[model samples]
Target: MQEKALSPTVSTEIITLTINGTSKQLEVEVWTSLLDLLREPLDLTGTKKGCDHGQCGACTILLDGKRINSCLTLAVMHDGSELTTIEGLAQDGELHPVQQAFIDHDAFQCGYCTPGQICSTIGLINEGKAKTLDDIRDLMSGNICRCGAYTNIVKVVQEALERNHKA
Candidate 1:
């Protein structure tokens, strides 16, 4: 006689996050990536999942006012965190300054990486380390634009930085 085998159970936990200014309490599997958590259950698709290995920077998002590659992190690791995707950057029907600057400067092509670029740029400016054009370049190197829009992207960052300094 043969015995029946038991199936493995999936681990799940409840987490609370303030996403795009809205508080969300979600139950997710423990092994789910932050990128999947945003794109799947939450339906916030603006944060793209490119490469899914943290190399392409397409899954970048602001976590606690700092930018991080969402694909590199697990959702369970960030409970009670404030998170922002591209969807969170606008307010009262007005685009964020960085979003407007990107439009004014024509900083994107194909736009797959635009969300991450914008989020990362905002994070860079907040850090206050980009004093020169070269510094912006170095600081933003993590974001890769396959369409080769670096020149205009840098222009947008420079202008946004200038505006931030003036404000």
Candidate 2:
């Protein structure tokens, strides 16, 4: 006789993480990815899942203060860690300097890549690796804006970088 399934089996893991300064405990499958966990149960959709292969920076998010491809990591792997998506950049009803700079500079066209651009810009600043315009451009090369807004995007990033330095 063919072996029958013993029982309807399901495994879930409870992960505790701080998202946008809010602590969340979610029961997720071991295979659930960080991007899916954020966009699905957490309802944080700002982090887009473009080219899910990590070629595009559309799925970028801050993991423990560093930019990482959320799609490449499992949610269960980040238990007890801090995460910052595009939604987390704002504070007290005010836009983050990077976000405001984007708006002021009109750095987006279709806007599908704006969130990633903004998030990456913030992370770029935190990394402290880009000291010149060319450096910034090189560091932000991973993020692709199909709308061809690179010039404006670079301006916005530069403005935000200077603004952050003044603060």
Candidate 3:
């Protein structure tokens, strides 16, 4: 097989986005995913790099108040959008309800997936699509926790849902 020479492509664009309540402006390659945007220059590593293919939901983040797999979309695509990562979910040195609920319920192990879990939980709650344990499981099916802590995770979700509903 003859090796074909590939054309080199280099294009970088400047984008501004609200990340974790901070406005960030950065120049990046067009192919950079939102996950890389957070992890690279922005240095927000709370969003995990699991699977890196949008399957595990480890890179889940809130884009414009909705949850999305950050690994699936390009950074330039979300210019001027609001993004909330695991780090952004907290307020005034206090954990977000979902984070607190997860801690109170011991909903994590190994901790690789906790960040994603937390972000996903917040997103799920904001979505208001889960009204029951089953609904939570079905809706949160994308975030894979190898620790098999689904029971505790579900409990946290249930608590957060009830609490958020009251508010």
The candidate maximizing lDDT is: 1
N/CA/C clash count, model 3: 0
Ten residues in a row with the worst lDDT in model 1? 1-10
Local accuracy by lDDT, each model: 0.94, 0.89, 0.89
Clashes found in each candidate (C-alpha, N, C closer than 3 A): 0, 0, 0
**lDDT tens digits, residues 27-55, model 3?**
98999999998998888998889999988
Model 3, poorest ten-residue lDDT window? 1-10
Clashing pairs in 3: none
- In terms of TM-score, the best-performing candidate is 1
Q: Which sections of candidate 2 miss by over 4 Å?
A: 1-9
Candidate 1, pairs of clashing residues = none
TM-score, candidate 1, is: 0.96
Better of 2 and 3 by lDDT: 2
Could you give me the TM-score of model 3 versus the true structure? 0.93
Model 1, which residues run further than 4 Å from truth?
Answer: 1-6
How would you encode candidate 2's per-residue C-alpha lDDT over 65-96 as one tens digit per residue?
99988999999888899999999888999998
Q: Which runs of model 3 end up more than 4 angstroms from their true locations?
A: 1-7
